[model samples]
Target: MLTIQFLCPLPNGLHARPAWELKEQCSQWQSEVTFINHRQNAKADAKSSLALIGTG
Candidate 1:
């Protein structure tokens, strides 16, 4: 498994457009993908835009 951790550099963060872009990129992967919001203690399946929006 590959793991990475980073902060959102964008002022508006994720929203919808970027979230869809991210979802598209992650879709190319064969492994499971997840978004972990350390500050909010939230976890979401990276394939879902609605779940990612909450982490923002």
Candidate 2:
């Protein structure tokens, strides 16, 4: 598994717009993509905007 770690630069964190954008981008990939929120102990499917926003 590949692991990537980065701080969110958005002032509002992973809100709807960014989450949707992320989902859109991830949808183009064939591999499974996931977003992990260490602080919240949350994991979300990168192809779903709702799941991404739920990470917060």
Residue 10: error of model 2 in Å? 3.5
Model 1 TM-score? 0.80
Q: List lDDT for all candidates, in order.
A: 0.80, 0.88
- Leading candidate by lDDT: 2
Q: How many backbone clashes does candidate 2 have?
A: 0
- The CA lDDT at 5 in model 2 is 82
User: Which residue segments of model 1 deviate by more than 4 Å?
Assistant: 11-13
TM-scores for candidates 1 onward, in order: 0.80, 0.86
Per-structure clash totals for the candidates = 0, 0
Q: Give the lDDT of residue 55 in candidate 1.
A: 83
- Residue 48, candidate 2: Cα error in Å is 0.3
Tens digits of per-residue lDDT, candidate 1, 8-47, equal 7776457898888878888898889999877677888888
Candidate 2 lDDT over residue span 1-56, tens digit each: 88778788765569988899989999999999989887788999999999999888
lDDT of 2 at 16: 88
